[model samples]
Target: MFKLKRKIMSKLYTDIFDLATAKVYAVGRRSVWRDYFDLYFILKNNYIGLDESLLMTETRYGSVFSQKLFMEQLAYFGDIKDFSIEYGLGQKKIDLDEVKSYLLKVVKNYSQSHV
Candidate 1:
């Protein structure tokens, strides 16, 4: 009976650890949308004046879906910086007041239309 109990407890612990590890992995992973936004910002900055080849290297992970979303946002915002405003500026390396103003107008228009 004791041996059976020990085996059951061990299985339970193993299951719990598996769940915890999965959660940890999920938390550490960046969503594809976030990756697209990072790439967009990098491109929008003219690759920070870096060589185009280097910029291409940075965008190596971009998939078809990410590219499509990036272009859609570009069309909607008319500028990459303005689209970045919607994602919050915590990750942004530069601040452009004009972009922020434009983002405000876009958000206002969107809100009004949805109402």
Candidate 2:
């Protein structure tokens, strides 16, 4: 039972890490604004590095993950229009433009260093 419990706990931690990493990597690939919002907070909290997140995302998504498309998507956010905003619990509201600006800057910095 002890060994089984340990295995379960280890898997749980790995799953949690993978989920968080995937969320961070989902920023550019997903169309929903919440993806970007979640990434803003994830990055704000320094949960994971962009490259590490991408690697984990690749593990989770296999070849379906596209770095080229992800970079392209990160470079733009014109599709997300202004809309009603809501935050859960203690979270505070943030402007859509602010989120976009933050993400764009992140991508720009990442691009500069990676290139």
Top candidate (TM-score): 2
lDDT values for all models: 0.39, 0.73
- Give the worst 10-residue stretch by lDDT in candidate 2: 19-28
Off by over 4 Å in 2: 1-16, 24-29, 81-83
lDDT of 1 by residue, 1-115 (tens): 9999999989976654443333222222433323334333443444331133223323543442242232234234332332233545575454545444443454455456546
Segments in model 1 whose C-alpha atoms lie over 4 Å from true places = 30-115
- Residue 19's C-alpha lDDT in candidate 1? 38
Q: TM-score of model 1 relative to the true fold?
A: 0.26
- Quick one: RMSD of model 2? 4.0
Q: In model 2, what lDDT does residue 7 have? A: 100
Q: Residue 87's C-alpha lDDT in candidate 2? A: 75
